[model samples]
Target: MKLLTNRTRKMDVILIIVGAFIMAVGINLVYEPMDLVTGGFSGLAIIIKYFTKGFIHGGIPIWVSNILLNVPLFLAAFLLKGKKFVGKTLFATAVLSVALYIVPSFDIVYHDLLLASVFGGVIGGIGLGMVFITMASTGGTDMLGMIIHEFIPHYTIAQVIFVIDGAIVLLGAATFGLNKALYSVIAVYITAKVMDGMLEGLKFAKLTYIISDQYEEIAKEIMDKLDRGATGLHATGMYSNDEKKMIFCVVSKKEIIELKNIVGGIDPKAFIIVSDVREVLGEGFIEYKQ
Candidate 1:
């Protein structure tokens, strides 16, 4: 148990570093240069840089704004949630700040809003996804979302974060103009999709419930041919008032056709319901990982 915990801790640190570095790269190279404010503290940092350019040299550095903006947030989280909850997030946020400071900025997009938006979205999405997979965040609105969820248990953390990020995007529009804001929206959407895909995985499967009188034969055929397992669930038909045997099975998407054919051949009148499963872990599927 101790070994597993230590291993997980080490892995989280590594992922946070990589995630933070990539996110900073997207900000410094594409988003910052193109003035595409997608949201979060990074977006706010860009606005700070813009507004302070007259007084500050090329505006306050993004890393400075990032750290300063997050200090209050981190304090709040630490007080409300405790160190255990804030520990990983604090580390990730600090790493992100350092990454922002050290990462060399070269305008890879050359002020091309379209290219900037897409590339920024993909890079930020993958980076954020990596951080999220470790159950940590780069602070800013991400931590704010978690704090908000403490008050609103009904909403998931991701949903709350989405709302917060959207508001920040609106702020970006106010600073960077609606044209840039619209393009930023595209980047934000892509980021969300890519992030969701990372966390949920790209693999899809089908779950089916089969009701038939010839359960024994159908189950045998499914096991023999499909090389899959099925379970018999006791169900009662309400109007008919009859006990029914429902076969429950989960199979790859490609196997759905053969499964249907097998059941249809044995019991033409068999009732089957197939549903989409986002992720399945176990034997004959993605093995459970630490």
Candidate 2:
């Protein structure tokens, strides 16, 4: 157990570093060059860089702005949320800043706003997803969001983040232009979708709830034919006043059809509800140890 904990910590650190680098690549190579400010301190950094070009060399670097913007937030997080909440995040944010400093800026999209937004969003999403899986965050808007949520307990941190990032995007729009801002919205939406897919496993399965009097035969058929296990959930139908074992089974996408066929064949009048399972783990699924 101790070894596993150490391994997990190491993996988390590695992921934070690699993810932050990839995120930096997206920002410097595509988003920065194209002036597509999606959101976060990175977005603010781009705006600062653009404005300071005349006085400063390449304006203020993204890393500089990132660290600067995040400092007060980190302090606030430490004080408000305590050391435990801030430790992993502080390290992750530092790694992100280092990544932004090391990754070179380039015109990856050749000034194509559409291409820039799409590719940048995808890349950023992938990186964010990786960092998020570790149950840590790369400060910036994330920390700010959490801090803000402290004052308003009614609103969720996610809601506060949406508002903050939205304001930043609007600021970017004002600084850049309407057209670029519009493109940034697209990038933001894409980033969110990709990030969600990352958090939820990419490999999807079907979860079927079989409500039939003949659940035993159906469960057996599923186990034998699909090589999947089915759980019999104790459910009481209020309307019918009937207590029964509702069959609950999860199967791969391909196996879902066969499962349905078996249930349909066994009990034609059976009530079957099928839904998508983002991920399934254990036997015949994702091995958690790996």
Candidate 3:
């Protein structure tokens, strides 16, 4: 038990270091350079930076604003998730925020808005994805999303984040005018797409339910040729009122095409329904068996 606990702690520490590094790249490279405010506390900070630039007499910098905003979110995470998660998340957020401040002090490499926006969204999205992949997150509205999701399991984390960030964008639009705010929207969209691409992959997976007389052939082909697994269930067709065999399996985007080919070859009229699965858990997915 002690050994397992220690291993978990080690993994958490590694996650913190790697997550922090990736977040820094996103903030310094994409978000900051492009001045894109997606949403959340970070979005608020970006808005504050734009209007308040040089307005303060030795007041807190934009980076500090971001750190300060995260403080409450960190506390929320501690209360919501646990002390261990809060500690690691706080360390990572602080490191990334500090790194963002330091990295820019050296120089401004690109002044072109287009270049800055493109690079910033891409790099930042990758960093955000890396942090999320480690069973942890950068504390902010994301923590709030976790809290809300705990109570409302049906409420999506991504949608929760989108709403929070979208609110910030509205506020930014009000303060900064329509043009800059619109650009921020573009950056945010790009950031989201890039993040999803990195987290889920270029070719995402879909959950497919195949109902046909050729279950045995399809199952065998998937197991042997595709090197995948499938679950079979006994079902009765509503229209025909006849007993049917349903095969359920998850496959990547490319595999879906192959699966269609296999099914077509086996049974020209197989009832196949495909649905998008946002995240998958268990062996061959995100988590492995104990």
Model 1 alpha-carbon drift over 4 Å, by segment = 201-205, 212-214, 217-229, 235-244, 251-271, 278-290
Error of 2 at 47 (Å): 1.6
Candidate 2 local lDDT, residue 203: 60
Model with the higher lDDT, candidate 1 or 3:
1
- Per lDDT, the best of the predicted structures is 1
Taking all chains together, the TM-score of candidate 1 against the true structure is 0.80
Residues 1-290, candidate 3: write the lDDT tens digits: 78977897788667666656665665655565555566666667767776676777533565788677876777667777788677667766776677667665321435555655566566666666666655466767656666677787775555566667777888877876677567666666676777667656733578999998989988999888788899999999799899988999998776889988888889999989998887777656666425
The residue-by-residue lDDT of candidate 1 on 1-290, one tens digit each, is: 89978998899899999999999999999988888888889989999999999998899999999988998998999898888768999899999999999998889987789998898999998998889888788999878877898899887566676677788889999988999999998888888777777876645899999999999999999999999999999999999999999999999999999999999999999999999998898999877765
Clashing pairs in 1: none
Q: List, residue by residue over 1-290, the lDDT tens digit for candidate 2.
A: 89988998899989888888889999989998888888899999999999999998879998999988888887878888888678888888999999888888889788888888899889988888788777677899877876787899787544566678778899999999989988998888777677767766556889899999999999999999888999999999999888988999888888889998999999999999999987787878876865
Off by more than 4 A, model 3: 1-19, 29-37, 46-59, 105-119, 151-153, 196-204, 208-218, 230-246, 257-275, 288-290
TM-score of each: 0.80, 0.80, 0.71
Best-to-worst ranking by TM-score: 2, 1, 3
Error of 2 at 194 (Å): 1.8
